[model samples]
Target: MTRIFNFSPGPAALPEPVLKQAQQELLNFRGLGVSVMEISHRGKEFMDVAEQAEADFRDLLQLPDNYHVFFMQGGASLQFSMVPLNLLGEKSTADYLNTGNWSTAAIKEARRLCDVNVVASSEDTNFDRIPALDTWKLSKDAAYLHITGNETIGGVEFHEYPDLGTTPLVSDMSSTLLSRPLDVEKFGVIYAGAQKNLGPAGMTIVVVRDDLVGLARANTPRLLDYQVYADSGSMANTPPTFAWYLCGLVFKWIKSLGGLTAMAEINSRKAKKLYAAIDESNYFTCPVAEADRSWMNIPFTLADAGRDGEFLELAKARGLLNLKGHRSVGGMRASIYNAVPEAAVDALIEFLREFEKREA
Candidate 1:
């Protein structure tokens, strides 16, 4: 079998060792004689798995005692509505930073439930750079200030967290979570879809400062309330048992690899290699500003836009797959998530060189 490297954005690559471990335990998990999927979520064994997963995650992030971590369903997109439903209260005004497609989608959702204040935006600059926080005009009485830490479509990122003055800060970190170390105390809530750096698509990890819970709107559904999930330990329903188990495996895998600090170092090296290749090549160009470029997702375009199809075809033929960029941004993207080995980036660089030579 050919060794293929997957560069998909989400439902992306996972560590081979984790896959192997799951395969080994598929029939019988830890002598339970049943797959983890078949086990009861409330059973002692699964409960232990859930607890340990949260503990490892907290340890990895150094989460404070005041913070509550909930592994819930509904991707980050769900949080767009839930954020306002749970945090907006009678306060109908919230602040949002519009960076790209995802951030815009978040803003649109918030508008349905509240009066959204677009604090700052890169739309004027074609979403090529994150607007400096110093230039933002935040509302004095806003309920919460929201930002998407990494804009997957634009390949733009906020390398440093923003300060929202006195307002509570919230972030959609779907692409950047677990890619590096973060100060959990800086924000009121941080949520990420599991498909990127976490595990699979069915789970979403939400970390909320304990004090922010219980602020849900009067009509908010029980399942959409942060405090409800917090109070119930994120098992309000059956939950995605298999995805939760896989996330546990991923968290363990990350710990065995020396935690987030070491992972950050590896991530930096991988991104540098790919970005350096783009920067040095006249045939290729990455439009995002250096300070705002995403380490996990890099979007670039060829000198000859007409040859986009040719580039993808050749790349796919060479075992490098899913290099296509999002439809909103018609270019090529290389998502070097945690599971994507550095060797894969090297292989991609080699292929880029070959493609450039042939095209030139």
Candidate 2:
């Protein structure tokens, strides 16, 4: 069977090694004669898997003991509400930075729960760049400052984080989480959906500071409360056992590759290579500001937009799939997540040159 390169924005590509290992053990995991998906999440074997995944995650990030990691079921979209619900403790306003679609969606959700103070936004430029950090007008009495580390659709990323001092900082890092090393101590909370860099789509990883655990509003549902998951090892109810197991394998895979530092170097090179091809070619154009361009997702357009369909059809014929951009924003987007190989980027670059040469 032939496998094509996949560049989906979500439910993206995964490591072939991880897939093979899972396949070998799919039906009789640890000789239990049952698929890992059929096993009890609370059983001893699955518990061990859960523990080791968290440990490996902490090790890769060098997380401080003060933070608690929870492998919850809802994706980052749910966190848009959960963040304000749990963190808004007596305060009426929460500061937010609107970088792109995700951050804008977060702000829209937050306004429903409380007063949302938009500290700054780059919407004026159609999210081509992040607003300058010095221009942010932080609120003194804000509950927490929320940011999206990367925008999957618009292809903008925050290369540097803000220091909020006493105010809590929350981030939705669905596309950026495992791509590189992070300064965990600077934020009060970090959450990401597993689809991009971690594993599959069923699970969401949430890391919260100890102090922020019990701050959910009184009316918050147990399922929506961070404290509930923290209290029960993220097993307050049945968890996503199979997704958790796969993510654990991904964590091990990352560790084997020298952790986040190695991933960062490789990711940087991959992004830069593609960007250079785009920059040098008069046939292609990437609207994102150079400084804020995402290392994981690169969006670009042809000089003649009419040929987009031809480009996608040709790329598909070449076994380079999912090069289509998000619907809200039109163009081609190549999401080079952690599991995507460097060769795939090289292949894409080669195709770019070939297509441009033939069609330009």
lDDT of each: 0.92, 0.94
lDDT of 2 by residue, 92-188 (tens): 9999999999999999999999999999999999999999989999998999999999999999998989787899989999999989999999999
Candidate 1, after superposition: displacement of residue 62 in Å?
A: 0.7
| Each prediction's RMSD to truth | 0.9, 0.7
Return the TM-score for each candidate structure: 0.98, 0.99
lDDT of 1 by residue, 1-360 (tens): 656899999989998888999999999999989999998999999999899999999988999999999999989999999999989877989999999999999999999999999988989888999898788888878999999989887889877886655688999999999999998788999999999999999999999988789999767788999988988999889899999989999999999999999999999999999999999998999999999899999999999989999999999988899999999888899999999999999999999999999987
- Score candidate 2 by TM-score against the native: 0.99
Which predicted model would earn the best lDDT? 2
lDDT of 1: 0.92
